[model samples]
Target: MNRSSSSRAGLALIGVTSLVLAATGAPASAAPALTMTLSSTTGPGGGATIVGSVTANSVTPVPFPAGTNPTVQFQYVGTTAASSACSASAKVVSPIVVSNLLTTAGTLTVNPAAVKRISTTKIVFQVPSSPYPVNDANGNPSTVNPNGLVLMGGQTSSRWSVCVYDSDNVTTSTLLATATYTLAIKPTITSILPASSPAGGGQTITVNGTGFAATSVATTATAGGVALTNVKVAANGNSFTATTGPRAAGDGLPVVVNAPGGTVSSLDPDNNSQTNDPPIPFSYTNGISITPNQAAAGTQVTIDVIGAGFSSLTFDAGAAPIGSGAHVFLVKDAYVANSNRGVAECTGVSVIRDTELICTLDLAADQLNPANSATMPGVAIAEGAYVLTVVADGGTGAGGSANPTIVSSGATFTVGPY
Candidate 1:
């Protein structure tokens, strides 16, 4: 080959190399140049921190707002979207823009702006409410909670990961690992309805709060040490209703709830100054009783029963072992015939929560007769002083037993003819 031809070929080769270098584009750049350090990362329910410094990606370097750090962005995103386009409105955090080079550690603050919900997964900083109104989805704008990170309604996505990005940008490509902390939202109880109930503990109660889940198997509601029954959490993950179990008389008993977000106690930790009771307390009544314990053998006598712990009975639901109303009876010991120890049943007995009811004792003379009673079977109901006992009949079921009959003071009554 001639020297001139070889020179032309070398020039051609150099031209091809230049084009290839331009096409490759800075060696494919590099992953986000930021490291995140966080505390609450794995589980739900609890505050956490995010901190780190931002450096330019090896290839195309984007400056960090010139000299000021301004603010960092936080977002909840599905694992798949971590490196994909995340919306501006998805900023569930409000971290401060402390430094440009250091990017300092940030503490989480709870925004007291009424916890308005724009969506289930994010907090929107808008006009008059937050200092930075640049985070709505309409247009990619500026900082959120420009001063510090403000946490609101605990709606941290259960399936999404909490992520941090440099500056006010939540862009997928700009996802800088500023910190590795979890903002998974701890559960909180705000209020309880019908705060007081009878010591016997059979009342329906409503609990209002955030970070609760209806579908979570771990959710529970408890008062004192007894577990509340029939707990139903609302679909919104904000509240639940349950029936209280019987508890001894007390003031300000704590009602603890455990849910997917974590555990929360009704006892107000900040208000422990109340020496007598908890701020969010449940009180139990001292006792339960009935009035007008005596009645005639053939006539109806009205009786009044009163006390706390009276829960609305759901007979068909089998919610409790006892049924509605009170049953009256006299033990076999009250029978004139010693051998006839069967209990004397009352007729027309009605019962309810602290309600009024009339009872009748209509035992036939033959049934009550104690003489020659060994040969024939009959309940003994005779003229004598006796105590009337009360029982409830919710009936028994598989692997369950009926409730026990109760005897209390003011239950003494004499059976006499009118």
Candidate 2:
């Protein structure tokens, strides 16, 4: 009799469970019979608008009534299960609890609303940042799980889902479907090359970093708070380029890159690494060109160098119009072959205009003539193919050794046998 009673109790329990499920209009078994998908898996911190649609396969799901459209209720939770909540199995509930964090109405307008079903519902809604939880399925508010972790403080991701309601209203609603997605991560910038350019802008700069999207529509590069132009991203997505916008001289503002995920500034550590993005070193000049293409050895020749950014320096414009303590050099082609053996370091650089400089090359003999030593007589030039490099030092004294900030570009010239 005892064994029979036990068997009967087991049957009774199963029947009760089935009746409870039937009354709620929910399936007795949890299966992915209803498929749900979100338009995108990632978005910004404020939130992202996600469009979702559901399709039913084997399940003969519940149909929404004619007067009532299906509803999509969103929930921000710690768990990934479509049918379960974070607070369900825990012996102690977390500090965070949310229900119905956000909601959207199904809009498939068929002649008869009654014919509309969960599988046919389509809805759009936004998912917000974390630390703030959303309402649970029961339409109750959720709070942070004190015993768990805090996610909203950084570029972190949390599980978000939308549940399809059999009825247009959330109250007394039956969950027919749910779709899960991961929150988007913020982008980071590591470096910007050609760090500084003329204040006039228009320089093509290269930005290197991680988490950059594939198109300009998804990314923006800026200098001194001004937006750049012709922005292009690399195939690897690790770098991008943009033409700088005009700005005043001085240490121009930080370079910045903005994306849907997040904004990274030159002020931020490189890709969140320990290093910082190098500052933009703006100036009044940029290029160099030497006049009188060629000269023979032993000839006293004066060459004119033209370039911009030679004038209107930001600070330390001591004595020279180009700025105080600035030094310019006409290094010889030999310097390229070997710095130590070259006599290319031409001295006595003279500034003729903010944008121009004059250098005298003493092709006379091999060494400085004591009578003209003060002019720092130029080094002897050999016959053959050679190029001269123009180096500008924005510092005090020769070579501007005091302050090493230097801007240089070249002009190639040849010397014939004298």
Candidate 3:
């Protein structure tokens, strides 16, 4: 008979069998035994949704035994290739029973309560919340935190045989899926050579720092309210050298070093920590100079000093010379008096030639006055005679003083139309 015809005939037989089984005591031998099948499983933590069907050949409505609690136990058998057995055993994830098989000729619907369906045929069977530690196919403990499904047994059996369902049928559980991650750390800056120098275009500064890779480092300089450019890192990746481009003279440009990764923590020359915990600070040496012993009134003179440590250099006129030294004045124009009106100016400066300080000056108004320019320009006779001061306002030097040896007694220069 055709499928439809067969189904109709089966229903008729089911009715007759039901009546007979209800009346007669001869346990209806014609009734077929119900069977279950598992379709699919899913979700994290080894949770699985199983799809199964209850089938019997007889037309009698096979009422699945009551109190029949069917449970799915998952054993974490070692990988198939593993020589030893899985240390962790399996436990019942989800327990269910065949509720009601309405018909024997058609598909039997298993209610949601009977089997939690994850998808069409895919059902998610609840697994233990605790992770199962098992060995992988390679004999290694599954490093995948909570290893998932392990297919054991049930190879030939219709993906749903009770014979295959039991633990006896299972040989070893095969790992199915796992979870996927990266590691990171911090960076630092160490030391900068030539800690002090004159500011302006042409100063080659070296910045040192660890963990510097490729173009991961940079340096910047700001002096006299101006920002310099062309910051670059060395090829070695440990140092960064660059020249100050067009900055005002006597400007103590604060050089900032930025490196890949993070902040640096190393002992500097002064034993100070370059880490800059309390104060993120760095040090650099520059090569520049300030000069001149004596000058006539209204003379535009350029002070030339040479040395390193010019990175963060500040200049002040009211600042005192070396020792109980004389007071230095920063003149504006060639007409200013010896008045304490010492205007602090940072201009016409360049880091020309190595680390040399190049600055231009316009004589003060009353510079020729007896109390001013009239008196001989106090000669800086010794090497340490001239010093670079880096104070907020007439403050002390940041990198101390550089004493240069004075070779000449005194040189004369005209400042005005005498």
TM-score of each model, paired residue for residue: 0.36, 0.37, 0.29
**Model 3 residue 331 CA deviation in Å:** 8.3
Give, for candidate 3, the lowest lDDT window spanning 10 residues.
Answer: 176-185
- The digit string of per-residue lDDT tens for model 2 on 8-77 reads 9999999999999888885555344255666765454334556666654555443333455554444454
Candidate 1 local lDDT, 260-330, one digit each (tens): 54567778623234444435777664434556656666454555545433333222222121223334445
Which one wins on TM-score? 2
* Superposed model 2: Cα runs more than 4 Å off: 1-43, 47-127, 131-185, 189-210, 214-218, 222-229, 234-238, 241-255, 265-293, 297-308, 313-418
Q: How far is candidate 3 from the true structure (C-alpha RMSD, Å)?
A: 20.9
Query: What's the CA error at residue 50 for candidate 3, in Å?
Result: 40
By summed lDDT, which 10 consecutive residues of candidate 2 come out lowest? 103-112
lDDT of each: 0.47, 0.49, 0.33
Q: Residue 31 in model 2: shift from native, Å?
A: 43
Question: Which candidate ranks first by lDDT, i.e. highest?
Answer: 2
Q: Which residue segments of model 3 deviate by more than 4 Å?
A: 1-4, 7-190, 199-202, 215-228, 245-256, 265-367, 370-418
